[model samples]
Target chain A: MTYVKPLPELTHEDRPFWEAAREHRFILPRCRDCGHIWFPPYSSCQKCLSFDREWIEASGRGTVWGYTIMCQPYVPGYADEMPYNVVLVELEEGPLLYSNLVGVPDEEIRPDIPVEAFFDDVTDDFTLIRFRPRNRTGE
Target chain B: MSKAEFSGRTAIVGIATSDFKALYGTDPERTREDLATHAIRDALDDAGLKKEQVDGLITGGTVHYEPLAYRAGLTDVRFCVDYPSAGRMCPMALMHAAQAVENGLANYVVLFNSLCFRSNQVKFGMGGGWMGTGLLYDSVYGMASPGAQYSLAFTRYQHLYGGTEEQLGAIPVAFRKHAQLNPVAIMQNSMTIEDYLAARYIAQPLRLFDYCLVNDGAVAYVVTSAERARDLKQKPVMIGGTAGRANFREWYVDLDFWADACASMKRDLMDPLGVGTDDIDSVQVYDNFSVSVLWGLEGFGFAPKGQGLEWIQDGRIELGGELPINTSGGMLSEAYLQGWNQHAESVRQLRGQAGPRQIPDCQRILYWGLSALPSASLLYVD
Candidate 1:
């Protein structure tokens, strides 16, 4: 079954980040001048205001900085996925990303827990970056 | 300019709110403009100023100021502006209007905020996908609602600061107690800490009580120069000092940065007001979410870092405690007119007109609000 959730509308600046997710590869925009890596890809470095930037591949491993279990469905598309965990992961490369934590129960999730990225192909055109416990054995 | 130059330059002479009870249910018969008109007329009457005396207008959350002025029977508006920003910018709007009156661009200015969320069936979290820029990252993950966004931040605060659900539960419990004393509050029943804990979690770590009520209503305040306000009907609630700051870079996505944003407000606002936290008789911190109030308490220098929940647990923030907070129920129990209602409550406290909820000898009060981008603070004195 295909996931019927609201998908990201790719933009000119953010296309590369979403395109990499489709191929199960995580990429972030890094400032070529200041060496500042940031999320939600932008044209310039937010720190140094430099337009010189490059797409750097991430290790796909991070610690859970914070998370919340959205028990209520604020959006209609998420009605079926009610009571889902939205996790903020601070990547080893030093950029935070928002994604879902899979392969773990709600009770098991905690801050600073190690997690690795895995792509869930929700539809042919869209793939979502999800996370799972790093210390757990093969699924 | 020196601090004394800005202190008591302008005053909020009159304030009013629409029928909060009529706002709870669907009011298809009334439009947002009607509420604005009602509040404006009532405020002018309270000030004992004729409608024609209003020479300036500042409106929030909507862009019906021209029609609102017409409906309120104001024919002479020298200066008019509209701020479509969040409720947190209410203080900023007041500050701008005060500046206008002080500069002689207008003799009298009115700031009005109104919303029909219940009647319009507006959902705050839905609609705006990512809301542009840095917020898109969180939106893609289904972290859209302000409640969920603030929950993530509050959860991180608890992790770093050693807070507990039971400790945070004290906030809504205190707010409900204040609400019971306010006849106009939407939630009149007192709530206990146990009731707060038992409530279901909309966003983990933030229970139902942590969120604010979404009833429809409007609030308006009339502003004029301090010299002119002295001649008005009610004693003027002088605007001592006002300041605003924004986290222009990461914006709302970073929870840890909010403390710094608020700290900037302290330096810019509190210093100019010439009053320390100890001097304030009461406080009206924005309670869009309960944790924001906790953040305000610490960020505004009432409590040290990692000690906000402790301050609440000690019962220092409740009515009759060391410092009373949100004596009119605030956004938590009162109708959410953004932060407009807070301004009205602050003025009431300063004028000693709060009736049963009045703080003893309330002469000075602080108001703080934090929207996603802009955070503002105002010091009001009698």
Candidate 2:
């Protein structure tokens, strides 16, 4: 089946982040004044309430902060993917990003598992930031 | 922090839950107005107060204000406002109503929540409206409603705090057992921990058994000053104290599992009323998901953090045990009134009206829900 999943509803402020993802680079809004970073793309710094922000590339290296498996297909387009896992990967930059942990089995999934981001160009307009387990030796 | 001066000044003089069908979609014809008016009239009757005496009204969860007041025959309600709907607004409505009455803004206030998820499943249930507005951006990953959020949090909690799915089964089992004594509860069929394990998982680490029922229902509470409660027909359940804080660190997730907010409210609300966890005869927690029960207990100082799973075992949270929780079966087995009925349950426990589920010497009760900004941590006294 074609992709029937709910896509991100992006506003102008949230566009740059996804636009960067389309280029296989993950970016986030950094407050120029306070050096605070955030995810899912907000306009201003949640801390210090500053609008002085610079969009920069993120390392996209993160650890598995937490994960959950969907035993029931609650959303549209997920019926065939029952029991799949959605993970919260806390990037080294300290912002938690929501993505799927690919190339790993359910039992192997646990917190603090090292993972690295890989971009998936889902459609002509959107590229999602997903993750896969990273091995030692920096491979 | 010092004790709030508003402590013990206002009391819940009346409480009633609307008659609900046994299950969702069974009563699709019942309108929201009828449900709200029924509970409001019943609550007013319980306090022996005329509808004209109610000058303040607060509503939650799909309940609009002006039409409801007109249908309920409440005239000249001076203070009318619609609080946000969902589990969190349950106690906030009660606290707001009490503040209005205590501050002399109104002589008597009625707070009601009418959830009609049955008739409007697409709007309330299937559409993901019940989950707060943020965090939908990750829907591509199959991250559905708040259940999945709890699953992720509970998954991390299991890693850090060491709780097992087997031990977590006790929460739903205990609440279902309590439902056997609550005549008004919808899911009164008895369940066991083994049965809990057998149930299908809605989200991993959280089963179908762990979720609250999504049935149609409404609940109302009559609020008045303690001085005015002296002449009421029923024993008034005094509003001893209330405190609240934001539990969010991320957009919508509490990575602490509501520990900080729970502890903050416990110190501010309970201590000021001269009550502790032991002194609290019962607790009514927001059981939108069963894990929240343990989260609330641990954060509110009933059990040490990371030990609630151990503390809740072996009928400890059951009725007549150390601290009976969700005695009206809560939203788990009882109808989901969006935590509104739990407030009524606390009031009933304090008034010694919980029937066979009543706690002995129930002098004090706590109604708490872990929530974002403007949450509620309320205490009631007999």
Candidate 3:
């Protein structure tokens, strides 16, 4: 069986973030002036409100800040993936990113668990950034 | 000009709620406008004020004041305002209405909310309707519903605080105990910690029992000057002090910062009332999800930080406990009216009108509108 999930409606500000994920490298906007790093791809820095920003490649390492096992499919596309894990990762650089935690059982997932980013090319046009335990690699 | 002037200047003179359970799985015979009109009429009758006397209109959550005024036969409305996106600002609508009345913008104001989620088949957490830039990150990852959003926060809370599902189970159990006494509560069936633990998980860290009932209902309140309220039909529940604040912009990504956010509102609300946490006899914390109540308990100074689950385990939040919370069963057991039911329960408790579930000699009640981003608190005095 095939599944089609809801896709992100890309805007100019979001395009860079999604484009970066396609290459299997994690990146976020950083303020050149006030030295603040932020997520969700804002043109200006949230702290200093400065447009002097750059997209820096992140370390692809973060700790599990929090997570949940989606017991029910909120969207029809997730019907087969019942009880999947949705995790919030606090990137080493400072921003928290929302993604899924794979390669770990739901009960083993906990806050402060070390994880690394991995990419899933759901389609040719879109790629999703997911995470797994820092120990194991391969899908 | 200052908190001193705002305290006790405006009062809630009348309150009314539509039948909560009756609207479940029912057909859409009443539009949102009709429900709003019905609640307004009921509130007007409760206050013994005619429709012509209502000079101000304020509403939130999909209610337009213009059409509601026309449907309620309110023609002399002087000040009209509508907060269409009032998620956590639900209780602040009363504060805004009070400000209008105090500023002489209007003499009488009706603040109401009407939601028909069941009848309209509105699924709240499906994501996609109003996608702001900030929410795009989570929406794209299948994290659409509010349950999933809040689960992230609560999961982090439990991890940091070291809590068990059995400890969290106490919240629903206690609320259901209170709901059993509330004749109008939608889920009056007795719930125990065992039942809560056994409930199917909607989102891990949050089960079916943790979520609010999606039923159709409307709640309305009439606000007027305190002096004018003395001549009305019911004993007035005075607006003592109201305060609200939003966390720094990282609200969506950082869940731990909510403790400080809640603490900020707590100080802002209590300072104006010239009272401390000890002065509040009862509370009506927003319980859209059970975790919200936990945050409210800690943020509102009812319990020490990171000890809300322990506080509930000690039975301090139950009826006949130290602080009787959600005396009308709250959103968990009561109907979900976007925290409007909490406002009505606050008024009822302050007036000593909450029959069997009434906290003995309730004097001052605190209501917290705890939500994801923006949060508000109200101090009501009898």
Model 3 residue pairs with clashes: B125-B145
RMSD of each: 2.3, 2.1, 2.3
For DockQ, the strongest prediction is 2
Residue-level lDDT tens digits of model 1 in A64-96 = 888888888776577778788888898889878
Per-chain TM-score of chain B, candidate 2? 0.94
lDDT string for model 3 (B1-382, tens) is 7877788899999999987866666676767887888888899999999988989998875878877777667778889888865456666788898899899999899898998878898767775433364336675677756777778888888878877878888888888888888888899788878889889999888899999888888999999999999999999988876777665443443365367777787777777666778988888867777887787778777788988888888678888989888888888998888888888988888788889888888888887765555556564665
Q: Clashing residue pairs, candidate 2?
A: none
Better of 1 and 3 by DockQ: 3
Q: Per-residue CA lDDT of candidate 2, range B67-185, in tens?
A: 88777777778999898666688667777887788667998998888877767663321223222343355676777767777788888999998979999988999999988998778
TM-score of each: 0.95, 0.95, 0.95
- Interface RMSD for model 1 amounts to 2.5
lDDT of 1: 0.81
TM-score of 1: 0.95
Candidate 1 chain A worst ten-residue window by lDDT: A130-139
Please, what's the RMSD in Å of model 2?
2.1
Tell me how each candidate scores on DockQ against the true complex: 0.54, 0.62, 0.61
